[model samples]
Structure formats: C-alpha cells, structure tokens
Target: MGKSPSVGVLHEDDCDEVKFFEKPRKNLQSDDENVDGRPGWLPDGWIMEVYCDDDGTIYRYYICPLSGTTFTTKSEVLDYLFSEMDQCFLESKNHAVGSNLTRTHEWLPKGWLVEIRAGGDNMDKMYKFYVYPPNRVRLFSKDDVLIYIKEMKISGFDTDGQCNTNTQENILAILEFNPEGLPQGWVKEVVFRKTNTGKIRRDRHYTDPIKNYVFHTKRSAALYVETGKVTIRAFVQKTSVHEMYSFEKFTHLHESLWKRLELGGTNQLRTRLSKLRKLSLKEEILSDEQGSTSAEDCNSDNSDTAHGAGQNKVSHLASTTVKRPRGRPPKQGNARK
Candidate 1:
C-alpha cells in the first residue's frame, strides 16, 4: 500500500526559503489539477509548494496570494476565509440603513440571523450588533451571544426562561466571602459610578461589621484587619487671609475616621463620637509639645536680656563714681589744713 499522506509534516516557510523553489507564473484554471496536489478542492489565488527534506520526508505548504502569508494546514486556510467573510459582512453593515438590517449568509448556520443598527443622536452616533438564534430569541452584543451559546451547551435547552439549570451565578456570593483571608465578618461591596462622559467607574469597599468600619480599598482594609493599624493619607486645604495652601497629610487610621464618619451614616453616631474623642486626645498631645517648645525659647530669651541689663547697670555706676587718688587718705579736715 502507498504511504499515507502525512498531515503533520506541513510547515510554513519564510521568504528566503521560498526563493529556493521556482514558483509557477501562470494560474491553474482546470479542476483536474489544483494546488496541494488535491483536485477540485483548492481555493482560488492560493498556491501550494511541495518539498522533500534530506531524510526523504515530504512537506506541503500553502501560500495566500492576497496577504503573501503561508499556511501549513487546511484549518488555517478555512479560518482566514471565514475571517474575510466576517470583514465583508461588517463593511456591508456599515453602509446599511438604521432599520432592522437583518442578514443571512450561506456560511452561517440555518435560522441564524445577524442584525446591525445605528443609534444615538447626530452628536453621538453608535452601532449596536445583535444576533437571533433559531428559537427567535434576540441576543445583544458578542458577550451575550457567547453566554447564550455557553448556556445552550451546558444545559442542552433553549434559554427562553425555561432552562432549569442555574446558569447565572451570583457575583456577590463569590465576592462577599473573604477570599483574601480577611477577618470573619467582613463583607465586600462594589459601587459603580458613572461620569459625565458616560463612562462607568467601579470602586470597592470592605465593611467590618465588628468595628462598624468601612474601608475604601482592599489593601487598606486588609492591613487594618490583620495588624490593627493603618495609615490614612488626605489632601488638606488651609485658607488664610491672603492665600490658600494645599498640602497632603498622613495620619493614623483612627484620627482620620472622624472626618470620614461625619460625611454620612447616622447609625455610626457612637462610633463617630469615640473616634472624635481619640482624635482630640491626639491633638492635645501635639499642642502640648508645641507649647513646651515655645516656653523653653521664651525662658532662654528672658535670661539673656536679664544678664545684659545687669552688665549695663554695673558700667553706668562705674562711669558715674569719682576715682580715688594713689595716696589713699581723703578726709574733710585734712583737706582743709
């Protein structure tokens, strides 16, 4: 029997390697002879090259004329063809009207419908793509289509609100539990905010039920839960009579909680009061240190002034007093005689 054709022996070659073989200039037209040595199956504009190595093993490679790229297997060629078809479909949809615009192609499966629609105002134009399955259910976006297909595969039923299997998992059930080995009563909450530009932003908050504390980020919450200490950084704005200064201040977690607690949460009234008391104690300690420094400076200045005043008094007395002569005796009666 003849040796079976080796499917795995085909490999793509570089431009330098293609220079070694003399390529056919004329295109093959008849179905009797085709590229890859397979009659009546090869695509147009694609040429095949066959070669033998020193070990006598045969290799076949397919080259694309449009892209000048090489493919080693039939699957690669099929993938390129389908991708080109999709590109053409998208180009056609771009010029289509804003109505239903449903289309079906020979390449698509039976009863599958694709639709493209242009929406939004003139200032903000957007295109929305949708797909309808054989069951006539509409799926929006590629992700929705993928999810629908996945559900069909897993449950083997049309997902028209009749599938008994629980396909959609609860995200909070996965996130609320402590995944990062956080403390036992801590729960995670996700907050989504939309900006003025219609963009969505997600923020994570971890809540500690035991201490009634809510941390904005995971790292900070983890640090406090594990170590009982955290550093909070905030931008402080100080306004004076003539100018305003903005500076960043880093304080201990407990001290900053007072300001944050004031923003909301009437249920945390006791917690806020306790945090305020702790904050006041810290401020008192800082004020005491500043007072002691100023007192020491004042004492030093007072002592220097007192010493200079004493020296001036001595100099003034010396200048005003009369100086005694070298002979020592100076009485009133001796002077008269």
Candidate 2:
C-alpha cells in the first residue's frame, strides 16, 4: 500500500501554467460534492494569505487574476468572492507549540489542511492556506503569486442591524466592551443613535458591523470593536451576545452539545434559543410560583375518591341481603294465614 501524497504535491495533469485563470473557467464537474461544491469561476490557480485581529474578525488577501478596483470595503470583496462564487473555501491556520488552535468559524469547509508561508516578517507570522479539491489545483510556486483569492466558502456574515434610526429608543441593539472593568452582566446594552450609511449594505439598508465579544471567566463576558458599533436588543442575554461575539467559544460549546452537526459549529443553537424567547411572553405564570408538586400526591388524591365509592357499594349489598331474608319469611307467613 502507498501513503497519501503530501500537501501541495502537484501532478502532471493538474498543473495549469497559465498565469491568469480564464474567467468563467469551465464549470467544475465532478462525481463528488466536495469537488463540485466550488464554483466554476474558482478553478484553482490562486495564492492565498489569511490574517485576523485579536478579537477574531478574519481577513484574507488573495492573489487572484480577476481585475476590479471598485471594491472599496472588505465586505464588498467578500460578498463577491464567497457568496457570489460559492466555489471558494477558507484554509485553516497552523498552531504554535502548546497552542490549542480553536475552530471559531462556521463558514469554511471541513477536513481542510493548513499550509503556511515561510518567514515573511516574523516566522510566527505566516498566512494560512486551505486548498479545495486537493487533487484538482496544481501548486507550482517556489515564488509568490501576485494575485490571490481573498475569501471563500462563506456560510454567514453580519449586515448592520436595522433599528429605527429616528427613534432615541435606538431600535438597534448595541453591544460594546469595557476591558477596564466588566459590567454587571459582564455585558451592557444602552440606547444611542448611530450613523447609517452606504459604506456596507447587506440589503438596501442595514449592516452588522462585526464586534468583539469576550467572556472573562467561562461566566464573565466582554465585547469590543474599534471602528463600528453593534446594536443588539436590550435584555438579549449576556450569554447570547457572548456566543455571537466569541465565535471560537460558541463553536466549542456547539460541538460539545451536538457532535453530529457538521464541521462548522452550529448557529442553530443560538437561533433556537432566540425563537424560544421571542415566542414566550414576559408575564410570569402563577403555576411557576406554586413550586414542585409531585405526581405521587396527585395520584393519591385521585385514588381516595375511588376507595370511598368501593366501601359504599359493599355496605349497600350487605343491607340488601339482610332485607331479603326478612321480606321472604313475612311473605310465606302471610300466605299460610
């Protein structure tokens, strides 16, 4: 038996010497979903480098051949790459010694290998690369490829919260962090006005500016963002906001609860909890205050009535027997007389 080929191992047929990928590259047709899942526009031949903030917002710079400088915002580039193509997928980052690399993202595909670049500035600072259809794209580079694939295989990204901008109540729920001292809930929600603009549009309006959410102890939480503000519904549990902000933590919890779920951690758990709160009213039910009533007590009370009825039936039968003897003797005596 032969061992599997190592990372970036190229085959003769797989090599594409073309410096640029032909736009609308022949639709990727394959028998397998993983092979076919990627877009035809994504027929390999791109170099990639991934970076992230301490807070966990990810950025990928690609050496893609495609040309268009109009994309002013990061969201615009991502929207076109991941959402538009459906062929792109993200690569995972390698971990340092004793460092537990956490999978916080739900967007990228599973079982993807991590490959890093050699010392660029610092040996520690290497770009993460994951190649899709490993058998398909040929890696032919000791030299750097100029154009790169910025992002890929995105499942979800946030758009701005659509709160009524005019209202002071601030329909948008804002989540902010105070690293100096943690708040009571370890998170706080306050009403404030924010400017809404065309910079990043999810639909016609609204943008979910990615924000930081951290938990101090598994219990205490923190949220921080440098440029934009996030508005969340007030009373949105600190845990809920915490889950949203800390993608890595959220993914860990998700995997622990339901291992059957796919490679990415579930947003399902968060969605289910949200729907539960929304469906229920704020009013307290009196039954809740009554406290623990056992099934034994209920069964005993119901059994008592049945026991009383059985006793009454026995007494009535006994009286009928006694009366029958007396009535029979009188009837015989009266007939003889």
The candidate that achieves the highest TM-score relative to the unseen native structure: 1
Give the least accurate 10-residue stretch of model 1, judged by summed lDDT: 241-250
- The TM-score, computed over Cα atoms with residue i paired to residue i, of candidate 2 is 0.16
The regions of model 1 sitting more than 4 angstroms off are: 1-175, 230-337
Query: Candidate 1 has what TM-score?
Result: 0.20
* Error of model 1, residue 328, in angstroms: 99
Q: How many residue pairs clash in each candidate at the backbone level? A: 0, 22
Candidate 1 global CA lDDT score: 0.45
Worst 10 residues of 2 by lDDT: 89-98
Could you give candidate 1's per-residue lDDT for residues 1-337 as a string of tens digits? 9999877533465655565453342122222343336533448767888775796455667886533557777787777676673343233234222111111121223334333221222212212223353565544344565666667522122323321123211111112323244533344545334334434445565654333356777787666643455447311223210111011111122222233223323346557888999999999999999999999999999989998998999999999999877886789898999
Q: What is the C-alpha lDDT of each candidate?
A: 0.45, 0.32
Cα RMSD (angstroms) for every candidate in the order listed: 24.5, 26.9
Q: What is the lDDT of residue 82 in candidate 1?
A: 60
